[model samples]
Target: MVRKKLYRSKKKLGQAPGSVVYTGERPKEKLFLEAFDFTKDTYTEKQLTNIEDCFEYKHTETVTWINLNGLNHVNAIETLGKHFDIHHLALEDIVNISHRPKLDDHDSYLFLVLKMLYYNNSHNLVSEQVSFILGKNYVFSFQEAEGDVFNPIRDRIKNAKGRIRSMASDYLLYTLIDAIVDHYFNVIEVLGDKIEDLETDVFTNKSSDNLSIRIQDLKREILRVRRAVFPLREVISKIVKNETNLIQNQTSTYFKDIYDHLTQITENIELHREIIGGLMSMYLTSISNKMNEVMKVLTIMASIFIPLTFIAGVYGMNFKYMPELEFKYGYFAIWGLMVIVFLVLLFYFKRKKWL
Candidate 1:
C-alpha cells in the first residue's frame, strides 16, 4: 500500500510545483464545506454545500473556521486559493493524499499537514490527511472526506465552551492540534487491548494458527501509527520554538503540552514494538519444544523394537542340521530369552532416564 501511494505521488514528478493533480483514490463521499464563525459572545456554525459561499466569512473579524472536507474538488480548492491568497504549493499538498505530515510556515498563514486515523465500520484502521491553513482571523481546515474526529471540538466552539471562543486564530490552531493529540491516547488504548488479547491467545490456546499473520498486521498498524505520530516531535518542536508571530507566546505553552503527549505516545509505540518482538520469539520457541517432545517419544519406541526384531530374524533362519529343531522345549526357551532381553533393555532405558 505504501508503494502504491508512492507510485501515485510520482505522477507529479516533472509537472509544475503547484499542480493540482490529486494523487489519491477518488472519494466516495461528496465534497462539503462547513463554516464556523464566532466571537466571544456570539456563535454561528453552518454547513456550506455551495463552495462559493465560503468567501463571505473571509472578511469577518470574528474567528472563522472554514473546514473544507473532501479534497476531490480541485476547482473549489483552487477557488479558495484565489480568494485567500494561499500558495499554490499549499493547495497542492492539500489535494495530494500522500503528503507526509509537515508544517509549512508562510508569510500570512501557517500550513500544517497531519493524518487523522479512525476505525471504519468494519473495524479496520483508516486514515485521512488533514491540512490546516491558519491565518490571522480565519482558519482553513481541509480533509479528504466529509467525516471527522473533531465533533467534540466543534461542540465546544458552538457553545463557547472554555476559552476557544475568546482566543485568537493561533489559539484555535492550538486547540485543533490539541484535539488531534488527545485522539492518539484513545488509539493507543484500543491497541493495548488488542495486544492483550493476542498475548492471551498465544500463550493459552494450543492452536496458535494464523497468529503470525495477525501479529504482522498489528506491527503494520503500529508502524502506520508511528509514522502518523512520530514526526510531530520535530514539527511541533519547530512550532514551539518558531520566531513566527503566527504562534503567540501564550499558545506556545499549549503546544508544549502537545509535544509532551507526543513524547509519551512515542515511548508507548516503542514498548509495543518490543512486545511484538517478544511474542515472535515465544512462538518460535513453543513450536521447537513441541517438535522435541514428539521426537523423544519416537526415539524411545525405536529403542524397544530394535532388539526384538534382531531375535526374530535369528530364529527365522531355519536349517536342516540345526540342533535346536529336534528339541520340543526349544520354542519355549527362545520365547523366554526374547522376553528377558526386552525387560533388560527396558530397565536400562528407565535407569538412564531416556524413556
Candidate 2:
C-alpha cells in the first residue's frame, strides 16, 4: 500500500474532536464494500456497489461482515458510521489511520483499531490501519486499501470448512484478527531471514558497502513492527477482559489466543531489535579492526624504511667527507651492509611475530 507521512496535517489541526478526516496517503478512490452473511446452515456473499446495500444486514439474524476498503472517502465512512450508530470518534479514528491499536466498548458495539502488517509487492513491510466495529449480529471492518490478510477467513467461510461459519460475529472478529496476527509470523520470519543474512555479512566480512544502511533499515523495520504489535497486546487483553455482550465468553478464549500470539510477536520484535543493535556494533568494530590492520601495515613499512632512509640520507649528503665514501668498494660495501641490515630486521620481525 502507498503510504504518506502520518503526522496530522493542517487540514485536521484544531478541528473539533471526532471530526472525520482522511489522514492517509491513499487518494480519493471509489470505496469497495464486500458483505458476507453466514450461519450454520446458510451463506451468502455480495460485492456491494452501493454503501446502502450492506446497511440492511445490520438487522439480519445471520452473522454479517461488512468490509469497507478506502477510508480516504470520508463521506462514505461517515454515512456508514451514521447508519451503524458508530460514534463520531470511532469514525474519526478509522479515517485517521495513525491511531495505535485500541479497543473501545460502546453501548451497542465494540470499536477496535489494529495495525495490519503485510509485505507489499516490493517486499517492504507495510502497516495499514484496520478498524473493527463488532455489534449484535454484524461486524464492520474498515481499511485503507482493498487487499487484506483475511482471505483465509473468507475461504473458511465460503467452504464451511471451519467453525467460523457456525459461530457468532465475535468469533468472526477473532478469526479476522487471528489472520492478521498469524501473518505476523510470516513477517517476522522474513525479518529473521534478513537479520541472519546481515549477521553473516558482518561476521564473514562480506557485507555490502551499505551494510550500515541495511542494518539501520532493519532496525527501523523492527521498531515499526514493535509499534504496531505491542499496543495490540493490550487491545487483545481488553477484548478478553471486556464485559461487553458483543464479545462472547467463549470467543474470549480465541481472543486470548490472539493475545498470546501478540506476546510472542513482541518478544520476537525485541529480540530482533537487540540483534540489530549488536549487528551495528559488530559492523563498527569490524570497520575499526580493518582500519587498524591498514594502519599496522603502514606502521610496519615505515619502521622498516626508517634505518634505510637514514643510510640513504647520510650518503646523499654533498660533502665528500666520509672515509667510507672515499673507499674504493664503498658503494658495494654499503649495498651489502644495507642488505644485511634489511635481512636482519626482517628476521627479527618474523621472530617477534610482528610480520
Candidate 3:
C-alpha cells in the first residue's frame, strides 16, 4: 500500500544540470565494491575495500565488471565518475534513482539506466535502479543496494561455464541486460497470480472487507511494474540500433533478443491491466447482486403479510351491535377463512416461484 514518492529530498531542486545529487535515502550500510576481471584463459574475482582499489581494472585488457552497492554515497560516486571519465550528466542520472530506464551513448562508452525488479522476503515487489557504464574493456555497474538478480550471471563467470569468458565486453553487457530482463518474467508471473486470486474471490463470493483495498493495491503495483518496465523497450531499441563502438555488431543480435523479451513483458503488462480492470468491475457487480437478492427476499415477505394484517385489523374493530359477534361459530369460521387465505396465498406464491 506504500506509494513511492518522486523526490525524497529537495537538495537538487535549484541545482544546475550534471550535478551529482543523491536524492534517495541514506543507507546505514557502507558502500561496497566487487570486481570481476575475466578473460578466456584467466579469471579473478575480488572484493575491494576502497574505490581506489578498482582504478587499475580500467586499463586491463581483460573484461572487468565493477559493481558498487550503495548509491547514497555521493563522494564515492563522484570520485569513480571522475576516474573513469564518465560524463557529469551520466553521474547525475545515476544518483537520481527516480530516473526511468534510458540509454546515453557516448563516443567512448554507453551509459544505460534500468530497473531491476524482484520480490522481497515478504513477497512484496521491490525495484532498484541499476546503472551501467559499458566501456571498451570494462563495465561499471552502480546499484542502490547489494542483492540483485545477477547471481546466475555471476555463477557463470565464476565457474567459466559459458561463452561469457570468451566473449568481448559488449557481449558481457548483453548478458547483464539479459539477466535483468529475464527476472521481469518472474515479476510478471507474480502479477498474474494476483489477478487470478482476485478473480476467484469475485466469482466465488468470498470477498473480505479489504477486497477492494487489495484490488486498488494491485492496481498501484501494476503501475509501478509498468513504470519500471515499459520504457526499457526504447532503451533496448536504442542499443540495437546504436552505432557506437561500445556496442559491437555481433552483440546487437543479443540485444535484439532482449528486445523480444521486453516486447513479451509489455504485452503481459497490458494484459494484466485489463484483467485488473475487469476484476474491479466484477467485484462491484457481485456486491450489487448480493444486495439485490436481500432486498428481493424482504419485499416478498412484506407482500405475503399485507393481506393477513388487513384481515386482523378488520376483525379487531369494536362493534357492540355486530351480529357476527353473537353467533357461536363466528370465531371458528373466521379462523378457518384466515387459514384458507394463507394457504391459497402460499400455494400461489409457490406456483409463481416467488419463494
Candidate 4:
C-alpha cells in the first residue's frame, strides 16, 4: 500500500484578533520590513519597525515600497489599514491566510492577493499567500512568512540598475508579481525534468510501488500549480482592462506582459499533465504484458506434463496379471518411450514458437 506524505491539516478557520488563541506563545512570527525609496537617481532603503513610522514616507514624491513580511501582528495591520484608508474587508482578507488569489479595486487602492509556491526538500509542494495593497504613492505587501522569493527584485532595486524601483508603486507591484510568476517557470521546469527522468525509468525498468506514488505526487503538484496560476490570469486581465489611475497606463503594458507569461506557464502545465497521463498508461500496459507472458509460460508447461503424469499413473496400478510387469525389459522400454514422447513435445513447442 502507498502512503500519502502531503496533506492539509485541520485548524481553526476564523479567529478574532486579540483572542487568547491568537496571542498564545506561538513562535514569534518574523516580520521583515524592507523599504525602497527611489526617484530617478536617488535610492534609499530602511528596515522599519512600526507601520505608523511609514506614514511620513507615504506621501513623498519618491515612490516608496513597504514590504511587511509577517501578518500575525493584528495591531500593526489594523494601524496600517487605517493609515492607508484601506477597506475593512481588505484588511480582513490580508490576514485570513486562506484568501484565494484575486484583485479588487477600491477607488483609492487596488487590492491583490496571490499564492507563492516552492518545492520543499522532500520534493513536496508548499504554498504561501501574498497580499498587496497598491495606492497612489505607496505599495504595501503582507506575507505569511518572513523570507520571500523576491530577493532578486530587492537586489535589482538596490543596485539602481533597473527602472523597476524608480518607477511608480504600480510598476513595483508589477515587478513583484512578475517575479512570483517567473518562479513558477522554475518550478514547472523542475517538474518537467522529473517527468522526463521518470519516463526513461518507466520504459527501461519494471514499474515498482514507488512509481505509482511518484506519478500521483506529480499529478497533485501540477494540479496545485494550476490552481495557483489559473486565477492569476484573470487578475492580470482585470488590471489591464480596468482603467485604474492607481495603475499607470504605461505600467498596464507590463501587466499585460505578465499575463502572457501566465499563459505560457499554464500551457506548460497542461503539457506536463498530458505527459504524466501517458506515463501512467504505459505503466498499466507494461504490467498487463508481463502478466500475460507469465500465464503463457505456465500453460505451456502444464500442457506437456498432464499426459506424462497420466501414463505413469496407469503403469503404477497394482494387478497380478499385468503383462508388462511380467516382461523384464518392459520397464526399460516404457522409460525409453516416455523420453521419446517428452522430446517430441519439446520439439513441437519450439517449432510453434511457444517456447
Question: Which candidate should be chosen as best, given TM-score against the real structure?
Answer: 2
Q: What C-alpha root-mean-square deviation, in Å, does candidate 4 show against the real structure?
A: 3.6
lDDT of 1: 0.85
Clash count for candidate 2 is 0
Q: What would you estimate as the lDDT of candidate 3?
A: 0.89
Backbone clashes, candidate 4: 0
lDDT for 330 in candidate 3 is 88
Which candidate, 3 or 4, would have the higher TM-score against the true structure? 3
Models ranked on lDDT? 3, 2, 1, 4
> What TM-score do all the candidates reach, one by one?
0.91, 0.95, 0.91, 0.88
Where is model 2 more than 4 Å wrong at Cα? Answer: 1-8
The lDDT for every candidate, in the order shown, is 0.85, 0.88, 0.89, 0.81
lDDT of 2: 0.88
Query: Using alpha carbons, what is the TM-score of model 1?
Result: 0.91
Candidate with more favorable, higher lDDT: 3 or 4: 3
Candidate 2 clashing pairs, residues 3+ apart or interchain:
none
Output the TM-score of candidate 2.
0.95
* Model 1 misplaced regions, further than 4 Å: 316-350
Local lDDT at 112 for model 1: 91
Quote the positional error of residue 14 for candidate 3 in Å.
Answer: 2.9
Error of 4 at 92 (Å): 2.8
What is candidate 1's lDDT per residue for 185-225, written digit by digit as tens?
Answer: 88888788888887887798554678888888898988889
